[model samples]
Target: MGLIAGIYSIENKAIDSGRHLDKMIQCQQHRCQGGEPVKYINKQIAIAMVNPLDSIFSEYDIPTNSHNPISGLYNGIYAFTDGIVLDVPKHKIYFESNGLPMQDNTCSSIVAAAYQKWGLDFMLHLEGEFSCAIWDEKKKRLVLARDPFGHKPIHYYSNNKKVYFSSEIKGILDAGVNPGIDLTSLSDFLSLNCIPYPATIFKNIFQVPPGSLVIINSLDIKIKKYWEPVISVDKTISFENAAQMITESLKEAVKRRMMAKDAFCFLSGGMDSSAIVSFMTEVSSSTVHAVSVGFEEEEENELEDAAVMAKHVGAKLHQVIAKPDSFFDMLDLMVFHHDTPFTDTSAYPTFYAGKLGSSLTDVILTGDGPDQTMGGSGHYVFAVKNNIFANRKKTFQFLSGIGAGIASALSIDPTPALFSKIHRKLYRQSLGPVHAAYDIRSYFPDIVKKYLCTKNLYDVHSAHNPYRHPEAWFKQAQGLDDINKYLYADMQFYVPDDLMIKVDRMCMAHGLETLSPFQDIKLAEIVNKLPGHYKILQTKNNQIITKYILQKVCENRFPEQILTKKKQGFGVPLEKWLKQNNGEKIKEILLDPGSLQRGYFKGKSIEKFVNVFLENKGDYFFPGPNAIAGLLTLELWHRRYLDFI
Candidate 1:
């Protein structure tokens, strides 16, 4: 709904905190279109925010609570919020229970009151997509917290003398934090197509991890996690009961997110989005609007399915067609909005969908979280099957090692074909269940990336292994089954880093606000405790079904075609587009002298790789269209964020 930024001088430096805040807000003007910036400043700190025109409190006549980025001063605590608090009534009840009645029901007032009573533990009682900054005036202490699933983003930079935080990276950069590309994060992007949390492309700026708080004072800065997905199976809960609980939880979640006068949904015709639309119709008094995007390629288009779902739900559907010609025009803008190198090709269609939806309403609902939380992704099935195979570790490793040795003895030269056929088998067999699942999700395997990058770039990042991030997450799910372990890691790393970032940046580029009902903390608390088999059901005939419980909930309510249709994920025809004339432009930019001069990749290796992909001659070793897109976006990001700045 808005953006927040601020600076704190640890040494109490005599700087103009208000002027610096003005510069930071100016950098994020796109996110605050139609609203003025608000600021609270002192000698040691400055906090500022800008709410959108359609903010939740816009209709209120109260002087202090008329808009978001609302602030409150109570009991020596000052608080500011960028998004809504869904459960304000719950907080009010708690305050009354403690014999400390609230004077106002505004989000900032509630937050300030709660912090005054419970201190930092107050974050555990808040429920919504928000990022808040609270300053303890008496203690000279500042605390920043993000919502559980990171629906709102917060980035910060700290040093011995000063600390800076913002809702977006550009704000911090504009506040005079010199931007230097973090090579380790560059390696992460090349491997995962997105950088993991707490580390951004910029070395100095870092994100505050989701479901966590960052406390900075004159002494030190500390981060603490207040929430995480817990795995605890309920043995007595029947499948029917679980499905019923999911149905109710989903409806409640949708109802809570319906805070705006006019809200629409991003319907991909997939079960998740369709379910959201169905629930929206059930809960809303007004007609629901659904937005969908399709591609020129027949195989990639889902307009027909989307129309079918829209008719079934009795909602008006708005559709947009994404063409290759407009790809180049939106490329730089996308990169700039992301503030980093993000190459999820689906972002193209997502951007167009948001643009269409923004014309109708500022708030948009999406079906984003279930794939990771409810095991709806196809990769879950792949992980389960691979885990089963990997369970027989000794036998599989022995056989695969012999096969690799035989291929070596035959002088296969480890060519792309042979490596794809032989070495990958060895690689998979040698890894544990968690590692195997991670490998299956990687955009580029570590060995393949080594051949692609220059020795210097590769070696500089050698000590900073990107896989460590996922491995750490995997370790947290230690007691769970392999499937749950993989899912937990995805929830912790991939969902917030890649999927959420793509949706948030693409939609917010046009000043749109998005909410995901499936990401509800209560819903996840129920779903995460279910056994792995409940999520990925296996039939007597050995057939695999992903999200079985969700399907059961939708069995009678949704059409059979929608319930049974294979999940064609929200993606674009990047391969097809990359083969067109635009591919030549990509090739030229990647191989241009300016690009090669950066020294990220060896000139000869990159030249051959780009040629191989454009000529339709790619192999396992050669880069594919997705990898090429990553490289192209990286170059574009450099030109805009690094080069221009």
Candidate 2:
């Protein structure tokens, strides 16, 4: 793994690109701890990278083939890769079949050779999680590409004159791009709990969407999608056959990721992580090292289950307890690492899990992708059921109105203290299946956001629909079944933006490289095409099973308890923890004179909201612990990155 950053001057301005590149690299030194730093500079472009000691390519300089300098023959071609490229033997074979000469077996050389042969299409042939930056000196064009599933992240900022790109947002910030809040993106975050792709918290900075490339030239910058998930169902494939294929594919994925002699697996005792541990043991001759994190709260603790899974798999288990004592300290670090207003409470446990894993090994494996790809989330089941009711929208709306009228006539209040609960439910029921499904994942709806924010901030984003970003993806999944549509939208937006960002940043902060077997592009190509019912199965007895196919794959290998166990998601007890001393600290920061003067939120509304939640006087419809966490993180981010400056 490595960190890459660079600057491309469209006007070829007299600027010191190398100096900016140096600061970018220096800011993200944690990513390249004990690694080699390399840079290439010219009049129009400057490229810099830091490859970890264990990276596949030790040298990232320009291609050295004199006989066939590839594109360098025209002028000079430079390429830098961050993250792994799996299936090296197959890549070499493909290169040989295509009659492409390679200077060496390293990944950098392979990329250069492939670019020479296929030009821009070279990324389509690579099967791994990576972000690569290629500069064409001849054309004076700069290209940045990310892997299909976006396992690696690339954040870039561009003005009309120059473009700056990096593996992390902090890199670009250090490269002289002043940071400013994007209110629309902040609304997106407040509504959806995450800022979607192509839109980051910083006004001008954006992420290179997964399976896409950003091409910057002297004229303009353009983005092109190189790959995407295709949902062409094969109706003839039987359940047994599909399960077998998934099992084999997952095993192969695990085997491919076990390239390092010392690698550990994050075992959460959930099906995803448990399945990964099971496969890791089967692929490695040595005993697998498993890591887990739990909180003091019993409901949030999964260490016992993780230990049980580890023992069953014959792996050594390492466990860590996440405490409230270090909560604020950890939050400060998390906000710094995330580089945005992130509200994934699970990131707390993930951060500690990565820290524990990094203490043991550099490379760590996780079970991250299957939930979106294979329909593992319980929310999918709810979406399917909700869609059934949502189809009878006319009847539902009539009944809801009649019920409300009858309650009013009888002077009965269903939600006396929380009237918004009834309104929210009725509003959601009025939406179609796709919108309803989207609402299921949203923390705060747009209407509530209006009340939460100041008029200035609210009015600026009022014209923009919070659901606009996700709706576009849902529209793309038009003809698919309801479940598939939800899965497709989630795969396109949620996984890459929220889940992947959480895992990638938390782990990378400690210099740990994480690999997700379920994120295998090959596996997704096969699984994504399967019918939705195969993933969320309905039995004759009226029982719904989520991730049915995956359970079937693990039926014999995993213990019966493990296979039948309900999915306890990687969640932390935010409510319980927020009531602790840290809660008071959060209140102090969020309600501080400086914080209130920011004018992003209504002071009175926020004070009342925080007081109600912290005092446990809020009703069911009130903003929960997650929303409070969002506010705290946003304020902390401002202090750490923006306010500090």
Candidate 3:
């Protein structure tokens, strides 16, 4: 919702140039489109903001506060807060808020009512999303914090003495910090679709994770988590009451998300999105605008469902028919925009869909978090049926089949062999104890970790949170399904940090704000208490899906065909794209010996992968690693950023 930028000298640089900082802050000016940028600079400290509060509010029944201008940045709207102050030499604090306060003088109020009581802990008590920074000049330190859910991102860089930080990565780069590509993050992207929190595609720079506050002092940098989802299982509620609570909570979550000045919804014709659009219509008096992207050759099932929902709710619908040519055209832009090697083929359409949405509104509401938070995929079914003792037996059988298939294929090439081997390893991990909540994450193999990353570094990264109580999550479950544990871990880690980060960054990249209704903390708390049956609802052929409660609340809102349709997820033709048109270019980037000198990947394995993909016997197109896509994306990123060729 806001941007922050500052540079502190380790050796007291005493430099006072705010122009670059202003340009950096201006990069996010779309976040404050209806207003202008506010800037302040002094020796050893600087700050820039896009908008200042209003000039008058008495007519609106909102209280007004007197403005104390810092070096002459006046309060405009007067009711809200936006402006930056840097009193570095004076050992004082400079602060601003975008649109949260009832009065201007209440900046003092945050100290008494919020900061003093909790100290840095005050971040948890905040209701709205914001990025805040304080320079303790006397202490020679800086403190930065983001809201608990990471609705905002803060980035920083330090060189022993001086520390520079900002809300956007581009801000730091504009400040003249070296913006080197972090191939480690690219590896993570290939493993997980998005960059993990605290690590961006940029080397040596990091984003502050959500629900976290970081302190940088003469001593060291420290980060602490203030909030996480805990298992609060209440088995007492009957199925009927649980259903009702979930229905009401979800409705309320959607209602709160509708408070934007302008809003649009991503429609996928699935239960989550359809339900969101339906409730949005029921709650709002305004006409809702819905946007969707579809393949020209894709089945019209989703489009029909989307059309039905739009008609049912009388929403203004806009569809972008995605032709193969369009994907090919935007390929470079998508790679450059992400600035990392992303393996998620769906990201292509998501980017185009976002482009379509940003053309209309500054805010877009999405249905990305619910599936993982609730029981959304085949993993949930596996969770339900998994038995630690019995599943291990099944695991051996599955592994044997995988092993036989790999061995009989008679390809000693380590790339495909390692690829298939790690998959079986994940399935083995998935079968572990039936209660390792981290299975959802561990589902992706650690090929890079095994051979690429060092034992010490990989151990540090793969080490599970010691605070996590796997037993507590498992004990809360009435049924001992492996899915519940997986869901618990996903909700705990992946939902807030990974999935939420992906949607937020993609939308914000185009200056579009995204509101995650499903990430409503209250709604997640309530749903966690529901019975297993209510969550799993009508498992068929061992597959589980969602929204049993939604049927009761608004049965007519979704089309019958959509309800019965198999889930055809958002996927891109990466292999098809590579093979049909750009295969040689992709293979060259990944298999090139010159590229191997980058040191993030094994050279030999990559060559084999390219060879096997060309032969079409690797089956690399599914839910596992597609080496060509990962390598091509990284090469594209390298070309655009590091090499600058």
Candidate 4:
């Protein structure tokens, strides 16, 4: 919700550089705490705090009645232990908060508390969402930290004399930092559609990972992770008891998120969203407001399903129809809004859905984490197979589980070709421990494989690490018969990076506060430990399905047709749209001389992909259109950031 920037000079005084920092602050001033900038300058020290949205205050809440007297502070940085400045000297250490606190502590409180408790390690305890920095006046050092989920961005640039940092990548680049793309990261984007942790588009510039802090003194830089997501157990509970427990926790999760002056919920007619909205309606006296997006009548529509739920819950629903015209218009806007190459075509409709919610409420609540937590993906079966294979000591049961899994995975009459592809690919890729290493390595683009990973990021991805290990990912899955490793990977990577990023940017762009009930600290823990059967149950037709408990919850409220519907997530029809007007523009940027000239991709290979896309009857929106869209989006972003043409 905000941007923070600071500079620490190693040799000379930071006088002129501090003034330069002010100009840098102006560029992201829109992100300042409601557009306010706090500049503290001393002889050798300079600090600047900029918040783009509302700051967090524990004692104060937005008056629900709208008639109560205002509290102590509206929007201001409360300094707990003020740092000293010498003779109007520039202060390079600055901290600011707008959306949510990373930890329960205030910026000054955490800094002061950290200095008090563990000396410099106090940062380990703080939680919430924040981007903060500190300038060491005497030693001429700069320190920065970002919240664990990376909802906030912290970009920094350091040379010989001064170190400049900010919450936006563009802001730091604007501060005279090199904006050139990191040659090593090109493959990272092509493979994963995002720069991996601790890396960014720019070479010298890097993003501080979530739950991490960075310190720089005279170019001696250090980055450390202070937090990670972990699943805890409540071993005493039975399956039925756990289901009841989850329901209760989910109720409270919905309740806490209702803490808004005026709130809206995204209702996608899917199990996850419908469950949240249903809970919200039951808890609130007034009807909850709901927003949804559907493609123009013909292609894939969810309006009827959304309407059914809305009627049952007595909520007022606003639906946005993604007519062909609207799809292209939104596509253009999404390219700019994302500011990067994102392959998730669903991002466009998701953006529109958020925009729709923004106009109606000051805050919007979403159901995002459930699918990941509950084993909702198609790949969960393979993970379960691998788990059974690993655990089976007896030949009979082990062989039986493997046969069942392979049969379940290979059953062609019922399952989609995509499901088959995912299952075969996972099993093929995970044939032995070595292929797991190869799978990890193949996840990156060839360009990155060749140039960037000299240290072998794949090899570094731990065998025991849940983030990379196929078995660990399998164990994390909640499905009954099949384990969804793709769901596991999606939760760890996609949920935070693409979905959460989309929500944060779209909502904050208009100053609307958005919260995710599924992100509740406790509910996530419970879901993480639930038995896979309750998470994913076998359908009568034998396809894997999600949220058996949730399905039962809505059984009386909605029909089977609605609950069993295919998951057509809020996404754009990018492939279909690209074939229309200015489609070639996307192709041009993707295959631009720049991507080739810069050696990010092989020009011939890029052309071949485009040719296949144009010729084949493939899933255009998934890979074909997505690759072109992402590449073009990045090219447009480069123009916006660099050429400004």
* Model 2 regions lying over 4 Å from their true place: 53-75, 93-99, 392-418
Query: Which candidate order results from sorting by TM-score in descending order?
Result: 1, 2, 3, 4
* Structural RMSD, model 1: 2.6
**Residue 409 lDDT in candidate 2:** 48
Top TM-score hit:
1
Note each model's CA RMSD in angstroms. Answer: 2.6, 3.5, 7.0, 9.1
TM-score of 2: 0.93
Structural similarity to truth (TM-score) of each candidate: 0.94, 0.93, 0.77, 0.73
lDDT of 1 by residue, 239-349 (tens): 999999999999999999887887599999899999999999999999999999998789999998999999998989999998988776687788888899886878889
Model 1: how far residue 500 lies from native, Å: 1.4
Q: How well is each residue in 587-637 modelled by candidate 4, as lDDT tens digits?
A: 666666775454444566456555556555434222356666665666666
Highest lDDT scorer? 1
Per-residue lDDT tens digits of candidate 2, residues 135-254?
A: 887777888999888888998898878889999999999988886989889888887789888889999899999999998898988999999887878888899999989999999999
Report residue 621 deviation for candidate 3 (angstroms). 7.8
How do these models rank on lDDT, best leading? 1, 2, 3, 4
